[model samples]
Target: MALCTPLTNACKRATASVPSASATSVLKPCSSRWRRGNATVAPPVTQDATSSKGPTAMVFMNMGGPSTTDEVGDFLSRLFADADLIPLGRLQSYVGPLIARRRTPKIQKQYAEIGGGSPIRKWSEYQAAQMCMILDKTSPETAPHKPYVAFRYADPLTEEMYGKLIEDGFGAGKGGRAVAFTQYPQYSCSTTGSSLNELWKWRNRLEGKRATGEVDPEGSIKWSVIDRWPIHSGLVEASAQNIEKTLATYPKGRRDNVVLLFSAHSLPMSVVNRGDPYPAEVAATVYAVMQRLGMKHQYRLVWQSQVGPQPWLGAQTSDTVESLIKKGQTDLILIPIAFTSDHIETLYELDKEIIGEAEQEGVRRVESLNGNPVFIKALADIAKAHLQSGSACSPQMTLRCPGCVSERCLAQKEFFAGQAKHLSAFSQ
Candidate 1:
């Protein structure tokens, strides 16, 4: 894969800036900032990469991590600086950098504990490939489902992926659609908001055929989004099934005695106060999973991945474990509810750090879901369902995000209009 970075004024312009030059002409020689490489001019993309019978590109969006220890600081910097993540307004420019710098050492230590980097990119690649294969088989009408990934904070960033897809004639030709499929199971202004906003910014730059102020042009990229599906049947079934297998880790006769702890990544109360629906959506996932499991065992939803001195959603996972242990309940299983793969949070925070803390309090075990096939398939199914009908967004889609009481969610309803504009009906 050729790695390229923006070096021209065209790259800096917002989506609808009419260019005297074509998009291909604006994209020039690869800069060294993308990777360690010689200055090499990329070949111009032809106008005929799309076929009416073939499928559109299916792009999976997620928060990425550094591939190695050396990239950790940059990754953290990018993550914190994003207005979508921290949303500190004008203060973000200063505060985001300061936070990233201040937290690097500790964050690096956490990454180091988890084998010196994040497995996120690798898992995302595997998941994308698997999803393409599944779609190819399950929905022959949408053949040749090209899979791409756009990580918000790391390599293969959303803009980079968008450039590649555009260069390939995606979203600019007949039947040339682009799908922004989010990997985040639940939606929040923080996670899905950031990713979609980045994508839309790119789409605005390449405003389909609508750019020339013409009718929806023939080859312009028709866009759709798969934002959130926290309670999808496939997803809920996968989590429950995985937990069922995890229950076996305990004594056979005492399976009912073990407590199930569903964990979600914590956001600041400040963010929640701003009306982020993350906590409610996370609870929805937990409720659906527990319903599917139908276990007599008790389960509770707890929050993890908290940073800074500020308050976050609770009961905190660690505090919950301590309380449970004090009540003479030592056996525990920690299932990361909001995560799709085992990153530093799952590997270090949930499994090692939390489990270590629990064992100190006489807790027996702590288990995590590490890219379970069932879960991966659930993700694939979510993507497929959206592909079959390209309209699963925040406000109103297949799920009940309409019931979101978050003022932010209510205010952000208009943002998902493009998703509604180009919905693909299910193909036989």
Candidate 2:
């Protein structure tokens, strides 16, 4: 989950793209060509007794970043232009590019601070490798679980992965199914929703190709998703392990003075009003991690990664840091609960900007969770568990928002309309 930052006014909401209805209406009646298309009928591919007819193309989905500094504008362009992010309707094509071009210089500086580009692709690829290794060992029945990275706005985009899957004979029974294993543990319409929607678009387009009698080379295409896993036991355990390890780094005496804070990307109130369940599910991850650590002193949860001047979830991290300073509490341990790896948001935003605030306030110590081995292992376990289970998603991993009332949940998907609900109204 990435945030629009001040360096770029990427958070400015454009008028909602689809008319007369919320984003939900655009997704309705489940009209994607992927779902409407026919399954490829092909000669049977022999499979070992333990193997499922096809290999698993597991793509770790994320909002990709530039590999080089110059490409940052391209990254920002795709991000700002996304209907999920800015919703500019027809004007998106015009203004979104302008927004990206305008923000480039400032955003470039931020990327430069973190070594020229986001390491998200690097980290996500490593995680995918680890997941493939685990899946190979633990679930031989689904052996040959080929791992790939799918970014919504950056390189190795979903469409790229889709073409590769079909080429490799994974489409429709060449013994392959695509798995969009979300990198988000907690669901959000902005993040996971955007990723899923894009993937669906690819499927819908592929449906057209098949209609032209372009047979799926090896097998029928199928999709399985592991979108929200906020409370997966493996994930909680890994987080607890990292928290325990990182906390010990602080002076023992100062440890008790420090607050264990969980920071997440913030969403606009308008997005939340549309029934985004991000904040609440994020809270669930924090609470679960807190429990695993067995902390008696209350921990904290705060939102970060806001951009532009629009309303966002709060107490904003900077504001929260200031409040803590005012209370004469400076020692802090920040766990980026929404991110699985260290990228711009963590390496620069939280580590520098936000922590710099604490330092300026005379806060003695601060730290963030970044690619802990345990966390990676837990992620592998989560994805592996999903594949071993027959359902599109593991039942245990579902974290639907409380009182989720979107018709799109049933209309567009059994899983994807899938964020925002049951939290206190947006406020600081």
Candidate 3:
């Protein structure tokens, strides 16, 4: 959920690279080659031939980072070119690449520092697989939930993931159900919205394109979205547990006095001004976690990872940390509130850059929610509710931003919401 803001432009659709569909689509296990220390888990449950309704695809959606230094250039380029993100207008083709090229070295260095890559891919795959395993038992009607990771940028891009789904026998006239579960707990037009738009774009492009492989659009995968769940109780409990673990490191006398700084990636005020729901939803998560902790220590919601010289939503995290220390509030716990997994933002930026600069033993960051059993259970609970409810998407997803002028957003929303017609048919 690391967002980079640059010069702004009116929202318009941008072209994306078509992934090589010819590439073999064998599902790979979590690779130890990426320096991720987490142990590999078994794959998600497969479809049962005996079950009438099974083989559901649970696709985890997020803005992914490069897995290695070699991928930073293309990752940044795809990110900057996304109109749903940076929105560089007609110059997107020219400006996006230039910016990505310029920033590649620095971003690669950051990734290099954080165990040579982002561990998000590893955690996402593990979480998705684990959640599906729970779902197979808990929601057996939709048994055998297979996990897929769809990154907006980096490897396993939207196109690649969609192709894998087709290869896995999801679409191509053999109708099935798939859930686009956004990994961002709080929804943003720049984050989850962008990912959905990409998914919708490919859904149209890849399905029913040619006579040789024509897909009956009506017979394609029936889709539903778990768009946002910023305040799920399980999520709150997991976050509270992590905070408590961090607080225990402090001495008894000082534990209750330590300030809690809950930080999330900042958005450009331009997006904020467009009535994007992210800022409010992120606040909701912080509030819920604090309440679950019984509001013991003082806390402030802060923003981080604002790139370029634009007006971004703040009280920036770095400035707040420095100010708090100056005010003699050195005992602080910094929590990465919005993101569920560890990435450069947490590993390099918070660990090496911010806390490293502070040079205070009193300052500490709570561990990320990655592979947290409670958090993984929360994911399964959310999916189970969605599966049983037969809803196309959350009601909140139907409305577009007040300032949204992009036709892509409108079409994408309508397309997903329209799946309500198909959900009832499949649930039986």
Q: Against the true structure, what is each candidate's TM-score?
A: 0.79, 0.81, 0.89
- Per-residue error for 302 in candidate 3, Å, reads 0.5
Task: Compute the lDDT for candidate 3.
Answer: 0.80
lDDT of 3 by residue, 1-428 (tens): 66373211011111222222223122332232211121222233244754456778899999987788898888888998886777666998898899999988878777766657777787778788888878878887776688889999978899888877866766645567899999999999999999999998788776643322443354467899999999998899999999999999999999999999998989888899999999999999999999999988899999888777768899988889999999999998889999898877788777777788888999899988888899999999999999988899999999989999989899889989998988885474
lDDT for each residue of candidate 2 in 33-150, tens digit (9 for 90 to 100): 2332455454433343556533566778988778778988888888988867655558988988998899888888877777777777766776677667676667776665677788
Clashes of each: 5, 16, 0
Q: Which residue window of length 10 is worst by lDDT in model 3?
A: 7-16
What tens digits encode model 1's per-residue C-alpha lDDT throughout 171-253? 43323556678888788777887787677655555543224343444445666777788899877877777777767766787
Q: Flag regions of model 3 displaced more than 4 Å.
A: 3-50, 208-216
TM-score (C-alpha) between model 2 and the true structure: 0.81
Better of 1 and 3 by lDDT: 3
RMSD after CA superposition, every candidate:
10.2, 10.6, 8.8
**lDDT ranking of the models:** 3, 2, 1
